[model samples]
Target: MPGDSRAATNAATVLRTVLEHGPVARGGIAGLCGLSPAAVSRQTTALLRGGLLRELPGPADGVGRPRIPLDLHTGAVGGPVAAGLHIGVPSSTFSLVDLRGRLLARRAFPHEGRPPAGLSGEIAVGLGRFLAEFDSGRPLLGVGAALGGWIRPDEGTVVHHPVLRWRHKPLGAELSAVLGLPVRVDNHARAVARAEILFGRPEARGSLVHLFIGNVVDAAFGIEGTVHQGPGSAAGDVAHLPVPGSAAPCACGRTGCLQATASDTALGAEAVRRGIVPDPSVPLLVDAAATGDPRADRLLRERARAVGRAAALLLDVFNPALMVVTELSSVLDEGYLEEIRTAATALSHVCDDPRRIVIPHAGPAVLPEAAATVLLSRVFRDPCRSDERARSHPSV
Candidate 1:
């Protein structure tokens, strides 16, 4: 078993190389992984046997001795998969991800105020049905549930999720007991940072901070390709951080907390207060801001400034190689991103001219993809193990 695990880890490394630079020659993989050509050949043979690698067509010009390249085979039998579920305040998403960073299937739905216990049961049934859709030869590694709140991963529990009204909920255990599979539960921001390490830009591997700006404001720090979770996984709690020039009252009896003034929910509420929108909803406020409403623009710009300030604080403390911001509307737009950057540069001592910043250029699936990455990472960690499981179980 240990030998198989090690082989799986090596196979995973090879698979990762192909995933990053697919249709790549065996010699290139050997050079990248620092393995001999023979070793690479053996690994490729095993991967092909396991149905994880497939050869792509060579040059169309019919050039000199065709050098075939390998790719991570998807939508095929024998590839490992994992289910990922992200539970938000208004909705939840279920996704399936292959170890090769391909999304197999995904669906989002509203919860209609189901309690945590009931929601766990619903997820169990849903996951069962989803898994049934795939070929049984496709190994299902496990499931990961991501949510917005404080999470105690070591204890396999959600310490608190204000939006879901969950406290001390055994989410991982509940799902595991019901689904009969391994389960991981974590904060959505933390999970997103992990996702970056697994599937984002190459630079995302080193020291970095992922700032998630949506209904709530939170951050996660990754160091040397791993999340730096502090005591009880509460390292990046920036929601309560105080912001200057904001007098908004916070639920914590404090004034000007980041969440009180900078979160999308807060901004939308402020938009309604300022008569920019009829109802307090982020989508509505975004629409108003897009339509050249001065009130909406001003409110969003102020919130963007607040976000920039918070990011500057993170940079000052962490001084990471880069910071990835994922805001719903403002940060995604170039003009608005610049506004936040300008405000942040003005506020922080060392964050001036902070050019080492980035945002996901990919569209709406960022959050769901991140959630799925949480589970897919396990397969990438050890492909041989997953392959073994796939072989152990036979589809009828």
Candidate 2:
């Protein structure tokens, strides 16, 4: 229903409250959301009717009647699901996620040369094959694509991806046309940050920074449980941040950029150049370091320092409550993380406890899960809004 701003805000608040503390009583929701029981009941009724929330049976205690709890209708195995797609430089991944961001299925495909003109169609076919394994009784909410480089989420276009040589690609629209589903697209690192905010342990809320350290070096900041997507969704473009004491050249034809020094590509190339590893790959370098190879250790320490410098710079600017670093195996070492902490503390004018920084070892499945969380978060953020679109399609 077309409603006033206050009503919309109330509904959104109730939905988020339920998502965060579901299987909870309406009275508890009212207290948590700062709304009266009557208001919460009204909003929850609307949500239940919209098929976004379900009521659980109340406990049969020997005392008075128990109040039924309200929760997001996401636990059902035969309920609706969302398709997540990630287009990276080396490979593409697809995953199925329920409304709560739980992974149902995941698959990856590696490609070489360049992305073809019919890449969207190819991905759509792959998703179709992946979906065939699941029960067809479940409805599909939409597809969320995570691409590297600049993205305009509002327009669902990838403005630029130098790694993939893609420019001004209407990826979301193309994929949507192929699959007959709604599509949303954004930068891969930012998408991962969104997932961290939505599904991470210790429940990362308030101010947070997520750093992705692999083939690319990018960061995303989450404030007040929402990612700080700046104008044009280009807020976390820290790849070009200048790094001191490094002579590496950046892809932008510049010297000493963060990506040139801290990225896995840079580390791998340096490992091969220094004869530490015959192959230029992160896994090989990490393996060599794990085996106590002095040369590999030296290279990794150098890269770790560079990443520390970048982290320091970010801390100075954002002063996030916590910083989550991904793909940095050396983070397990107190000495290694101390290097980052020391640099950040020294460089950042606003100092906080260094222990706030953490590294998440999510393995290869992180990207696919990140892509799916992009769609899942939207539902949690505004169930009423997304439910409208879901109602239109009913099933996909």
Candidate 3:
């Protein structure tokens, strides 16, 4: 490898080591990441200079300065922050997160009655206001925008989003132009996968599959800590994956598709059709179920089983170390997750251990943290490049 590339890789290694085991000494970082002490020192110096890492006071037992602990600069002041934007069909979420992907503040922006053509502009305006209200003079790294679609992250374009009616839209550039900050765009499925690998379970780094069941249903796969984005970055399109025992009709003239059978949209509509909820809203259905509505609980369980059937197919194919399900009811309630695990384990020939399937570690805060991971992931991969990109953009 080239000299610069090797240095960047070493820098990322050191950064991730500290992220996993922070407030640790330089020698500990070298020991954890298997790098030489000199290399660890070089990267830590650069990271501290870049304001990504900070040095805490050394032990008072007369230990040398080299033994001082270091951690991600997550202090109340001067610590850098990343902005997150999760654009769902019905609403958008804006979040401020620190280096560790912790949510500092968040706001929801509903898109009711907004035209598809002008939706991005409206979101930009609302997001700008959100940032202004939450800005505490911290170093704003940039924005990471995640949504359901065939996204080209490298080009920062939305190749296709059926729900949003977006095609070949330069979403990242538009948002950056309006917000005057660096913006990275990616599919929410992959974003969640990356977030899991970075901040969730340790087993996720070995291998994992993430299934997202929101207004849209999609999946993402990761191996060896890297999420896969196939040709044109459109790998996670599981909307039409067949779900066994489900005969729900899909708009594509197909029946038993995963999205049609298990997505929040389908579940909400089913709840409304059953007179369990007044409107097609997953949250309302969940609320009803929580309030002892048996009808709503049964509907959620039915969708959970359908999601499990689809997850069974994925497990049989990939057999990843972990299978993360990001669904509203399942994340909020363990009963629904148990239903999914039971159904998946029953159907999956390769996976009998229900423990392998779990909800995202962040739970209710999953989308916001995952959206921000779109940019935070880049920062961990190559902090130098991310810093340069942030420097190019106007400070928030």
Candidate 4:
């Protein structure tokens, strides 16, 4: 691993490799990372000096003879401390966590209005309160803001958040400055996909796709261990896809869009029209379904059919090894998962094993998992190493 400018960044990767899949042997790390023994030793020394990692409290992970192993000191200042925020249509979740993808503290803030500045202020107050009350004296790392709609990751800008009426806002810079922490912002489903990839299950590290059917119905695909963030970061917006027979007008003014037929808005509105639920909150409708309400059951079944169809299309395009879905009601009530399974199975082309589909409940750890994935990107492709290595290459 030779390059242009980021010797330190490459060094960080060496440490992360050991910290992540390490305590492994130095030769193993050098072999996997393509660095010589001397290079690995140099990086390891720098990391130990920085106090980011230390020898494991036990015997080494030696290739032949016993050797001393290395591991990340969880209590290290710069060790973990990443945060993630998921802003939904009506509610937003703010979380603080560590590198191990554990949730230290999290609080959900329900949206009351559409003023960005005021809402930001209130959210800031909430985080400050959390910091004063529970944030350990350890150094704070960066925060990741996860929201719906088209988000430009490199620029840290939100091109459009239809639900929040946020257009061309520097959400990343603004929130980072306000909260006094580094920021990483991206599409909500992508952030959730990050969580699924890193902390959900070991198998998820491979090619996978995550479909989040909630306030925002979006899908993200991870191929060869990397989430495909297409040009302009629009790899997963299938809501505008004109699936036949849906019959509802979407924000794009398209007919039969999936969102019109499959979103919470569609289901809740349909249930309300039939006088089953009073509003467009799908969770409440799901509550009714779980209570044996015939009308709610009917609505859920109909919605599941449409959602499964959308998932089928996604599977055809990505052909991922697994699908991790986060559905609102199904998480709260395990039985509702049967309905989701009915829909997915009715449409999926995944081989005979349904275990390939994992529906996990949303928990506090979801946020940190999202933030860590963003940081984890740099761990895999050290920008610092790439820069320096660029110089090592013969010029064209």
- Most accurate candidate by TM-score: 3
Encode model 2's per-residue lDDT on 55-78: one tens digit a residue. 777767733222678887775644
- The models' CA-based lDDT, in order, is 0.76, 0.75, 0.93, 0.67
Per-model TM against the reference? 0.84, 0.87, 0.97, 0.83
Tell me which residue pairs clash in candidate 1. Answer: 8-384
Q: Rank the candidates by TM-score, best first.
A: 3, 2, 1, 4
> Which pairs clash inside model 3?
none
In candidate 1, position 222 carries an lDDT of 93
Candidate 1 lDDT by residue in tens digits, 1-396: 677666666787887888788778888898888777876787788887766677777666765322577887765666667788887766788888776555778887677767655776886777767667754687676787788889987666988877667789988878888887778778888888888788777778877898888776779999987897788888778889888787889999999898888887788787888888898787788778788887877777777788888888888888877788877665446766787788777877766665766675334566777777766665566655552354477431
Candidate 2: clashing pairs of residues: none
**Predicted candidate 3 versus true structure: per-residue lDDT over 252-311, tens digit per residue:** 999999988888888888888999989999999999999999999998998888889999
Q: Candidate order by lDDT, highest to lowest?
A: 3, 1, 2, 4
RMSD of 1: 4.4
Model 2 clashes, total count? 0
lDDT of 1 at 373: 71
The worst-scoring run of ten residues by lDDT in candidate 1 lies at 387-396
- Which regions of candidate 3 are displaced past 4 Å? 387-396
Q: What are the RMSDs of all candidates, in order?
A: 4.4, 3.5, 2.4, 4.8
